[model samples]
Target: MKILANDGLDQSGIDALTAQDFEVITQKVDQKDLPEFINTHQIKIILVRSATTVRKELIDVCPSIEIIGRGGVGMDNIDVEYAREKGIHVINTPSASSESVAELVFAHLFSGARFLQDSNRKMPLKGNTEFASLKKAYTAGIELRGKTIGIVGMGRIGQEVARIALGLGMRVVAADNNVGKASIKVKFYNNQYINVDIETEPLAEVLQESDFITLHVPAQKNGFMIGEDEFALMKTGVAIVNCSRGGVIDEKALLQALDSGKVRFAGLDVFINEPTPDNQILNHPKISLTPHTGAATLEAQDRIGLSLAEQIMNLLKNK
Candidate 1:
């Protein structure tokens, strides 16, 4: 079987495929040339990340493709339902990168609370002259120990975040349409773990009660999930973090909230339009931003590759 890792696959995945005597192509293919390349190579499986788009048009043109694999959680880049309707298996390693994404959520949450992003950017330029002033400016940081962190979606990633929050001595409340409750296993540095049961609350209740809100929901089909009304329900000066899908939170509403002091700080790893996020939020003083790299850790990539390889082997091998 032939597989094209168009957006680039990790070495672990490539080795796994090679061990099974499968041909794995890691060449970069332009969107325009994808159909021709797939047809020419007789590729049966196509793997992608966020950079590549696997829409219905491409899937229709490439008749040989039997499976579509995504390296991360979101399948926004791929037309999953359309592909599945045509008998193509669409697979993603949702659990593989949970820890990595959870860590990034804290990275932003901790840094934003302490004003690290601003300090890092300004320190180099003004540290020599304004060191004492900068120190005093950031001293009003919030401590996460006793704060409440509301998770919007309590899936694998959300549960992982909850684990970290619990370990930090923070209160965790989550809201999910599908999940009523979840048992999170919090692990400590001493190699000990404890399971805690948490019951999910209503969206409005979570919003009104939490000191910090983190989003882990899927991309909304119609419009923004958290906009003016949702923002209004939230606690004043609440810090928000979104490392999930773009278009889940309205960027314009977020900016306005920031301006009005309704939202104290925002940590965003995903944006409405990736690669080119809104300039206003990018330049905002109260926002901490990262290029959608929640699942970019080395360990996450390796796990993603291994998981994809195993799934591919199960489906395509011995066929």
Candidate 2:
């Protein structure tokens, strides 16, 4: 069988697939030419990350494709239901990158709490000239311990974030309309563990009470999840982190909140317009930014690759 990892799969996954006699191709294929390329190459499986889109039109034209695998979570980039309805196997590794993304949430959270993002930008320019003034400005950082962190989703990633929060001794309040209750098992370096049970509450309660809020849910279908009204409900100086999806929170509302002191800081990995995100948001002094890289860690990519290889072999090796 032949596979085209349009967005590139980890070498570990590529090796695994090749060991099973599957030919794996890792190269950039233009979106406009994907259908022709698949047909000409007779590729049996197509693997994508966030960049490529395997929509109905591509699926309709590429009959040789037997399976569509996403290396990371979220099938929003691909037309999942439409492909599956046409008898094409659609698969993703939703749990593989959960820890990596959760860790990234904390990365942003930490940056925001300590004003590290702003500090880094200023230290290089004003460290010698305004040492005392800079020191005074960044002296009022908040500690993570004993603070409340509200998780907006209770899925795998959300649960991982909760585990980290519990391990750090922070209070966790989660809201997931779908999940009523979940358990987080925190393991220490010495192998001891603590099991914490999490009972979800309503979104409003979480918004009103949490000292820091992190969003881990899928993108809202109609509009942004956190908008003007939602921002108004949040505690003053509440920090927000969004690693789940772009446009999950309203950018305009967020900017207003930051300016009005309703929101203190924001840690953002994803944005409303990706690749070419808004210059204003990029230049915002209060926002800690990272290009959509929640699952870009080495461990996560390897896990995603190995898992993808296994699934691809099971589904298409014989076909």
Candidate 3:
């Protein structure tokens, strides 16, 4: 069996596949080289991160490929249903990066409240006293305790976020359309969606009421989920954190909110475009920007890579 991996895999992952007498290929192949490589190797499986797009065009090119494995969560980059229609099994390691993503949300929460990036950038190069004075201004960070945190999704990742938030003495309000009352132990609000407490109101209520709002939902099928109107509905000076898919929140709408003082701060680990070459928010003083490193931790990489390897190996054995 042959597998083509777009991104490099860790040593353990490589060893696992090699142990199964499977050949794994890791190359810097762009879209042009994909079809040829698939045909030449008679590739049975392909593993990719966000960098590769498993669209209908690419799927059409590699009919011999029987399975696709995404190293992390979010199949937005891959054409999942389309792959299914073509009789290709699509598997993703959703749990592999859950902790990494949850940690990122906490990281952003701290960065927003403390203004770490701004303080780091403004510290004087030569004047120690000036730097000391500037650092004092950033000390006005808000405490997370006693604050109401609203989680928009209550799935695995969202539940993890809630657990952490509760541990920090922050009240958690979850709103999910799919989850029912018995599904969650947390207190549910009245007249809301079935399971999720806090009476699942529209998105606007979540934005307006919570002291902090974190989005954990997958990407929407349309233009954008959180747009200008949604931003407008948010409480003034509310901080927003997004570690999910980039298009989930409208970047333009967020910028406008930041400009008008509607939003106090934003911490973004993902953007609408992966590897944003000309990211406008990189230098935004109020926005904390990371290079999509939510799942870049050593532990996360090991788990995701090994998990993907295991799934791929299982598919090969079953075939």
For model 1, what is the C-alpha lDDT against the true structure? 0.94
lDDT of each: 0.94, 0.93, 0.81
Please give, for residues 136-224, the per-residue lDDT of candidate 2 as tens digits.
Answer: 99998999999999999999999999999998999999999999999889999888998899999999999999999999988779998
Candidate 2 lDDT: 0.93
Ranking by TM-score: 2, 1, 3
RMSD of each: 1.2, 1.1, 4.8
Q: Show the lowest summed lDDT stretch of 10 residues, model 1.
A: 310-319
Query: What would you estimate as the lDDT of candidate 3?
Result: 0.81
Which residue ranges in model 3 land beyond 4 Å of their true spot?
124-129, 181-201, 277-279
Report the number of the highest-TM-score candidate: 2
Q: Which residue pairs in model 1 clash with each other?
A: none
Rank ordering of all candidates by lDDT, starting from the highest: 1, 2, 3
TM-score of each: 0.97, 0.98, 0.89
